[model samples]
Target: MVLQFTDVRNQSHIRCGLAPMEGVTCFATRLWFSLTSQPDFAMTPFLRVTKEYPWKRVSSMYAAEIFELKNAVSYKLIPQLMGTSPDDLERIATPLLSGAPFVDVNCGCPSPKVVGSRAGSGLLEDREVFAAFLEGLQQKLGHDKFSIKMRSGFLSESEFPALLDIASSIKMAQLTLHPRTRKDRYTGRANWDLIATASRECEFSVVGSGDIVDFNTLNTLKNFAPNVNTVIIGRGALRNPWIFEEIRSGKSVCISRNALLFSLATFALLHEFQAHNPLKLLELVKQGLFFTPCLTNENLWQALYSRLTTSFYGTEQPISHLCLDKPTFAKVKMIWHALRSGLGAQFMHPQLLRSRDFCEFEREFLNIAKDYNDLIPLKYHSEFDWIYSGEKRNEKQESE
Candidate 1:
């Protein structure tokens, strides 16, 4: 049974969400997050709706998987769709809309591939078309059934007020603002001031995203923006699936090395059972290990890299054997680095490495966290001190 938006809002606590991420947040990962954490709602990664596309075609197989995820999570799981025009949405949204409890429009994807096609945040570039698209959606699926996920603007902050006006006119069930322009991508700090401003300007509930990876930030956001009652977490949840549980329970979260391995083992069993592909499952583990923030301990990177390369699921042979070609390893390293950097401004940017160095990085996985991996590492808060306290600092500097 799915909960309505009002039902979710009426809850006493601040609502937490697993944000929609294209490659990282899939059914398997969502299941892991739901079972391991306390997200009140979760969203499937954005589905690119195209006309007469084979991959977009809905199947019972896919529906059954969604059903299984629903059974596992036992909460609101919204399916998000992306398209350039209303025609694309009308053409390809049936299977998903029919199966989902509620639907979301994707207007905030910043990938060049998505933007080049004028589909994701690209829609925001053309205000007239975007407005018409929302109007058509309301006509097609009443006001209560859908929501919109968007960035502050396409290329500039100037576009947001106009965009917000159009979105509010439709009475969208909710509006989730990522608070960064497409130009910002995920490198800079998220503009929570814009989120707070939007909450004040618009009548609908506004959900904030970006740079919220721990309980402290969650608390800070709640106190900072009393109007912005919900937050959608992507990388934070991936790094520590127990984050939500810790936030809701208000307890310090400490994971022993064995407990962490045991949790991954359980996730591996479920992922393998569902995906039946060791290669894909291995990639997810690597992503989790790399994206999760770590303290600057001498052994932390070594332990993490080891876990990234070796098969932790206890398969007869290591997952490295499943890689069809040699070059895949290099691509994995580059991709993981980029993803980690994209989460916060302070993180080092990812760069391609020489093959030998890449192998060395892989081999460094000599030790997996021999010590416990605390989800709420002390420095996690310190890393983003600028974000939570920048306003006061700026005022002091001005006074000086």
Candidate 2:
């Protein structure tokens, strides 16, 4: 059965969404995952609904990425835009509302550059402006089925009840809380209790966001916050696309090294395509929540990073093949350093990649992109084909 956010105008209101990350989540990633992992919606990478780029690096955030998403793939596309002025929002909403089926306002990105320029999560500090931005969107879109992706609060967790109050007053279509204060950023654990309590106080459809990937985590948090009917995952989805299936089935599927590599390779191909060329993201991966120990070793990390930066999925086999020296944490960190430095401080800033200890190489796959014959390694794949199932892939097929 298809999961939905709400039944608005009889159109599918997307429930599962790819959270918009400036540098990390791009058009290619969305198109690839929608077909392979097939999440129900892809929000725009925190757009600045203004006249110009807030930061010099991500001019790609010039608008809602509406046309790009439409041209790339099909499912329900929700273009998220961020701006302080309703006029600026209206300028962006005018075209997107006419194009994309779903739309959202970003009140959750916790970057200083975003907050400094009064976009993304920064608007949280100004309730009146953010509210007006929503109200303007509500009037333009002609429905109450929009969403706001946000962190817990600006100053304190105690501010949640009032935040929910302010949200309820505006009569939002849905509220998605990332559950971490901007100050905590992505470091601290997300608070499900706050979401549960907010759901208790409000009648609006509430979706919980945070570190939700594994079925157990989803089950635990869902049970604890029974009021939250839907969960939005960002980093978790990168690790396991079948997470939705796991949640629906309530059973754990044994994940393999090959499977993880396949997912990463596909994502890398799409990432490179979207950016026109893969910008090395060694920095982002180090800071990326997507990397885990089992899925890779050292050589494997370098292989995929090379593929992404250079457009190689390493091996096109239906199943993955790992090496003894594959993606170790070091290789993964190396990839992060290469990409993060070039992408600049849009969202996944290089500054965030630093940690106290150096990560070691974990998996084994060599950087074949250095040699043309290296493509020979990806000759076979296992039974794990598409990460996601059904219509989304059909849509990708039809479009192609």
Looking at candidate 1, the ten consecutive residues that score lowest on lDDT are 363-372
Candidate 1 lDDT at 289 equals: 35
Q: Which stretches of candidate 1 lie over 4 Å from their true place?
A: 1-12, 54-56, 59-69, 277-368, 371-400
Residue pairs with backbone overlap in model 1 = 303-367, 305-365, 306-365
Estimate the TM-score of every prediction.
Answer: 0.70, 0.62
lDDT of 1 at 132: 89
The true-versus-predicted C-alpha distance at residue 97 of model 1, in Å, is 3.2
Task: Quantify all predictions' global Cα lDDT against the true fold.
Answer: 0.61, 0.53
Which one wins on lDDT?
Answer: 1
Q: Compared with the true structure, what per-residue lDDT tens digits does model 1 show for residues 178-225? A: 888888776556777878877887777788888786777777776657
Sliding window of 10 residues with minimal summed lDDT for model 2? 377-386
Tens digit per residue, CA lDDT, model 2, 182-258: 77666546888887877787677777888665566777787878767666777666545444444544554433334
Clashes of 1: 3
